[model samples]
Target: MNIKYNLVVLAAFCCTAIGSAQDIVTQEQAVKLALENNYGIKIAKQAVEVAENNTSVLNSGYLPTLTGAAGATYNLDNTEAEFSNGAPPTSLKGAESNRYNASVNLNYTIFDGLGRQYNYKSLKEQYQLSELQARETIENTVLQLFSVYYSVAQLTENLDALQETLEVSKDRLVRAQYQFDYGQNTKLGVLNAEVDINNDSINIISSYQELKNAKRDLNVVLGNALNPEFAVSTAIDFKLQFQKDDLFEKAKTHNVALLQTEKNIAISELDIKSNKSGFLPTIGLSGTYGWNKNNNNGASFVSVSTNTGLSGGLNLSWNLFDGGSTIIKVRNAKVNLETQKLQKENILIGIQRDFENAWEDFENKLKIFNIQQQNIITSQNNFERTQENFKIGQVNSIEFRQAQLNLLNAELSRNQAKYQAKLAELQLLQLSGELLNVDF
Candidate 1:
């Protein structure tokens, strides 16, 4: 009965341990989680919202401003006054007075040399620029996530390969021991086998550490708790079908960075137009309605008075001269407009270069991947044959170890090539502004 109870406890502990392990996370899930939780993306979204809010007509000065105010004041004083022309003198003690006023005023810019119109257009363009910037931020974050996710996958594969190598080394050690016990192999052979096993063990430990570090990095990108343990589904295959010319065309039109620079150029051109408006006159209209009342005490001829009135007017303002500052501003705006044009051109050039480089990298990596795929099969066959020969004393321990190492190295190379190809593929998609839209 006591033994049964201990077994139940042990089983429960094992179940709990299994249940506590982290769930497997896929690349899509990682991207979704990061888009939802990443602080940078959230901030970027807020900035986009701010720009949207600023694009309103009210913010662009297209609406009239109206204000209303009312106030009253009371005064208590001892007063003495003399009229020089009439030769009269008057004095009052503890005199009390009150005044009240209320007004409503409205003002609107009737005309400003089309400055307001250009300003509104610029604001709309700025909002678009901010949206593109936000998308750029999201794209960058997704790229980082992909890089880390695949890195974890690569390391995990390498670790598995190393574990297999360690197992092979252990098998070699066992065979060497058996042969030595049977007087068919020297003690030196057994020692060498043990050393190989130890070396493989060391490598396995190092690979595990690297895998852990990579997973930690992935967790950071996922905006999860650091150092959390989780498995990632490996994505080792990628297909590229777009031509360079087509991709370049898409990049020129769809790339977020390039689109943003183009918007900037548009805004700069609008600024030049707006600054040039300074040479023209501004027209405005304003109106006000008000009531005023005053009360006087102690020896005043008029005891109380009230007045109400309505007023309206149009006003024009022209900056005829200001130390040549308007001319300077217009010149500067033109220069800035030119600078923006140059920047747009530079961005276009950069996008072309990036697309070309990423395409070449993908092509090269795909070739390497194909070669490694063949190499892995050869190495695997060689290791198996070497293992069979070693078991029958036809192959020495060193040759068996070499075969094992060759298989391990080949597998590692294959894994690296696959991941590098995927990375290049992702880079190409990113440059073409298609990564965010594609299903990973």
Candidate 2:
């Protein structure tokens, strides 16, 4: 009785392990996991944080600097003094001295041709640019996630179709073997059927391997362990409702890349102003308060002394000449500004081109999807008719095999077209900066 109980326990454990090894991941869950755990998105978020931290008022030189310091020293030495008027020399052994000092200083830049103001503005814009760049990274990651997820779905469909074809081939093989055993069919027919069965088996294996690879890639995108067995939801559906003109207009302003370029132009203009500020005199205020003490141990004259004082001043500085480097910098900054403008134009052109290409692809895939959808139905009917005919010995194996292949190819094509259409639609939305808000 105990042995039987142990066996039952072992069986239950095995079942639980098998069940826990397989996971069912929906598309929405995959996207959420990627957003939470993707390494690239995390790095981009950190970069934005760094930019925010660097945009402080102190970094822009708007705040004064205050510093305080103190120190003390002790010394011991032999001292000798020579009197010029008297022809005698005097010496003392083990002379000792001590000294102390402390100070607090403040410095503030009063004026620098509005350079600080421009610098502050540029820093703010830099922070904004970093944020846009992070958003771009997120969008790209999400798009890639969607693509990989759909690819796995497509491969899964292919694997299913191949399995179905393998079953059909196996059935044909069995029929051929039975006929051969009864001396009703040629041995050549049995051999040919065996070859078809083997071929179908090989195709199924290959399709399953491809599906595994696709799932591995999806795991990589989701930042999950590579070896886990999981299944993705098989629903692939999306819609595009915006016109081309509307998409173009939205992309012009909302696209992260273009917005980043605009920020760069503004930053470059500020850079020019900052460099020009070097040509103007700068004004500042500085103040210091200090105390000092000195002691000569057991000395008759000036045994101890202490002093304290407070001092303040206004300072002015001007870079009268710098071998023309400042002016050259200003010129280069202006050139950079122009380059940024040209870059913005180039990005706009590229964005328009991408949007047009994606639009075209989306439309083309929709058409292909429709064609393949009808093809699958026709192929299925043909395959069924040919299969029945083969069973009745009214059609040859070659004709029936061809119909089977047609049905398999049609199903695979339809699956691919459906996913491809979804991908193209996603890409179009991505280019228009609407992908961030898209529902999975």
Candidate 3:
């Protein structure tokens, strides 16, 4: 009874998964889901935003700056005094000399060592690199989504096939039982049929479990609730056709990872220049405005004086000498830039090798799929003939069963080849940065 209950549950689950997953998922939906919820893409987008903000700050440095200042001063004694010898002078003493001053200063960098200019340019490049990184992230997410989507579709087909085999085996078992009771078929034949049915029943359950797991993974990838029922369309096939030479040329221009590496090298070289620029002179314009008044109670209140002045000059301060710090930094920056260039070269080599290998794999799988399609047809015919012979007593049941298994295996292989070929093609397209061009 327990086994019977388990079997019933398995059947129900299979039906549910298949019925709910019949709708084909669109490429647009996949891309939208990935952009909205994929964690990597989300992080990359945030990084780009941060870089933009940083660039804004860098740009602000080129603008004029204004600042205000206010302060109060208290002196315990009026310490300085002068007197004439021939005339009587007023002797004065104060408990405190109180003073207050307020001022506003404006500053502008009319010229610098061009450090600000270079810094801003480097920041702009950094911002572009960040944007490209985000794009790269999206590209990666799309490829991953496609992989899981097709994987689930492949499993769906396998489950359907297994369920069909299970039903056929069950019917065979029933027929064999009737024949055995009538003394036409032996009990062994009935038992063999029952065994086949049970085996298929197990396979069907396993396949359903696999499908469930696949669905769960896809849900996580889409940032959806795992329990939500989703019907994905299985009609989409992975098909990509792009000239390798053309794609390679496009990648040189458009591949974000490669472009980012090149950007790194450029920025690193800029870093060395920036560090060296520190040794150059800097120039600026500065001005100040303020108001002051002097008052003594014994005499009379003095008039307020408002002082304002503007000063502009070329200021040059070069680092005449340092304890080899500048040299060390410049050398480090140069080495780092060289290292980045070397890394970019390595990446180029790696991309070329990977593209070549993936293309070969895809082509090889295509050929295998073609071969397996023909083999499946031949195996089906042979299995059918064996079945007819078994019923007419010209061949044993064991031989018939073996032939049926052969046909089942052949069909399974053929289907696997088809999907495998598609997988290889998708992977190759991804490697060549051409997956995005594939139409749904």
Which predicted model would earn the best TM-score?
1
Which digits, one per residue and each the tens of the lDDT, describe model 2 over residues 93-196? 88899999999999999999889999999999999999999999999999999888888788767767766776677678788989999998998888787677
Worst 10 residues of 3 by lDDT: 295-304
The residue ranges of model 1 lying beyond 4 angstroms of the native Cα positions read 1-22, 75-89, 225-227
TM-score of each: 0.90, 0.89, 0.86
Error of 1 at 381 (Å): 1.3
lDDT at position 190, candidate 3: 86
How accurate locally, in lDDT, is each candidate? 0.83, 0.84, 0.74
Superior by lDDT: candidate 1 or candidate 2: 2
Q: RMSD per prediction, one decimal?
A: 5.4, 6.2, 3.3
* Cα lDDT of model 3 by residue, 1-440, tens digit: 46754775677567666766444556577667777888888899999999899799646479889899887766555333334554444444674555677778788886666778778878988999999788778777877886787777777777766776666666677778888999998889987886776677777778777777888888778887334466565564656656778766766655667888988988997888878876777677777777554433332234333444554444555667778897898899999998999999988888888777877888898899899889888988997798778767788867877887787787778778887888788777666666666665
Q: At residue 9, what lDDT does model 2 achieve?
A: 46
- The top-ranked prediction according to lDDT is 2
Worst 10 residues of 1 by lDDT: 10-19
RMSD of 3: 3.3
Off-target runs (Cα >4 Å) in candidate 3 are 1-5, 20-23, 57-60, 73-97, 225-227, 236-238, 251-254, 293-314, 393-395
Clashing pairs in 3: 23-232, 23-233, 24-233, 25-233
